[model samples]
Target: MNDKTEELRDIFTDVTDGEETVTESQEDTRGSLERDERSTEERLESVVQQMRERYGFDDVSLSDDELITVAKSFYEGDSDAEIADALGVEPETVFEARMALHLVDEDDADEVDLAAIRNREEDDATLADEYDVDETQIRRYRRIAAAEDESRTANDRYRDEFDSVLADSELSERMTTDVREDGLEDATEGMETDVEF
Candidate 1:
């Protein structure tokens, strides 16, 4: 073969070697990452279990990693709305967390329940009063009172959308909205009377 043919063959061989190297490196990276993720998930599950046992809120508990993940979302300058958007949860959840978690003296896990609840109630009362609310919500803290918090925001909508997709599009089938828009035409017909001079 001529010299040029030999040079081309050499370059092709190098390219093949580079491609194989990249593929192998990618496989190795993915394997290590999956192993680490499995371990993290197991640890997170354990933390939530412990929290449930301690708090008797078996219906409600926060994993250490999950709490940290939520905290990181806010510490990184995420508004409650933004954090709710990122975490695929309701905005009220984000606010409840931002308010309650701040009371967590992580240095002392024993103080978490007592301090967090008391502090959250105080803060909620202050916020409710500012908005001229009766502060009744501040008195009786109910979990997941959708009726009380009918104004579920965009973040909740996003989570509902995600959940709907995951449930094979059955999420909204379980929910019934108070208002149904037959169409814009019908909704505006009542207010369309002439008001001109």
Candidate 2:
């Protein structure tokens, strides 16, 4: 061996208490990681359950499993139309379900007069006319306004928990990569050329 190699070996031996090989028991190192023992799904489900109990998802049409899907898709930054396609429901249904779960899109909130919706005694149709948007849009804005009155932002309501659980599991990166790859594949699926370059 070269002098440098010999010197590294000697140093390693000295640092490792004269042992040629450094060994550590898995148990000795495991606790330092601070990992959650639960599976990703279990962690997400626990968070969802906590939300369901805390918020009392009154009049929400989605099942428990569907709600979980909504949470996951929302955390993945999927649009309501995309989430609706995944859930095999209409976008309006998904929108209402999102509102019920306090998953208000900031853009949606920004588009409407939340204060007017909050203080007015007018019904959704009237609000829609005043806002020059559809009744569904008015209804969604009203729900967002109500959630604001309750002092909860989208993050405070549920996104933070979903973000935490997915980020911890490293699923967020994987899912995002997968979605991007799928979109790229779909975009190029039919553009192959017969001629060789």
Candidate 3:
């Protein structure tokens, strides 16, 4: 050993009363390990329960399992019609359920002015006539706009939880990479050079 090595050895031995061997006791990790053993479905159910309790979604017609299905399908980028098919419900029902769960799509409230609707004193029928939209459409848009406002106040915590439950980061990254590579290949399909570098 070099001088520095020998000096370190001497210091270590002096600190250890000339002992040459050291042992360390690891912390008990069984509890933490066991906690992580829950199935994905169970974890999702737990999060759904927490959401229900936190938001008191008493008016929602969807059951716990249906709500989870909606959230999972939504995060997976399914359309309302597709989600409705999965749940054996109409698309309008799914829309209402999404509003109840604070899952408003960006375009759901885009057809009319949400600020105008919020400030107006007219009923749904009157607003629908004034906006030249269907009465149900007016109601749906108003509810979606309200949910969006509420979600903004809550920092979109519920949506984040919904995303985390089904949107695997690794899978998303891999899909993104694959899509980018495919696009690049398509863009360069006829650009190959005849001369070698």
Descending-lDDT candidate ranking: 3, 2, 1
- What would you estimate as the lDDT of candidate 2? 0.73
Q: After superposition, how far is residue 121 of candidate 2 from its true place, in Å?
A: 2.7
Give candidate 3 regions above 4 Å deviation: 1-24, 27-39, 169-197
lDDT tens string, model 1, 1-197?
Answer: 99998797778779898443334344334222122233333543454344334444323234455555665554455676786777777766665553333222122223123323443535666745654555554443323232123214323442332222323222333331212343455688779577997
Comparing 1 with 3 on lDDT, the higher-scoring candidate is: 3
Model 2 stretches astray by more than 4 angstroms:
1-35, 150-157, 167-197
Better of 1 and 2 by lDDT: 2
lDDT of 2 by residue, 85-142 (tens): 9999888777766766566667868876687668899988987887889987777777
Candidate 1 clashing pairs, residues 3+ apart or interchain:
none
Rank by TM-score, descending?
Answer: 3, 2, 1
Cα lDDT tens digits, model 3, 68-123, are: 78877877789899999999988877776787667877767777778878757788
lDDT of 3 at 17: 93
Maximum-TM-score candidate: 3
> How many clashing pairs per prediction, in order?
0, 0, 0
Best by lDDT: 3
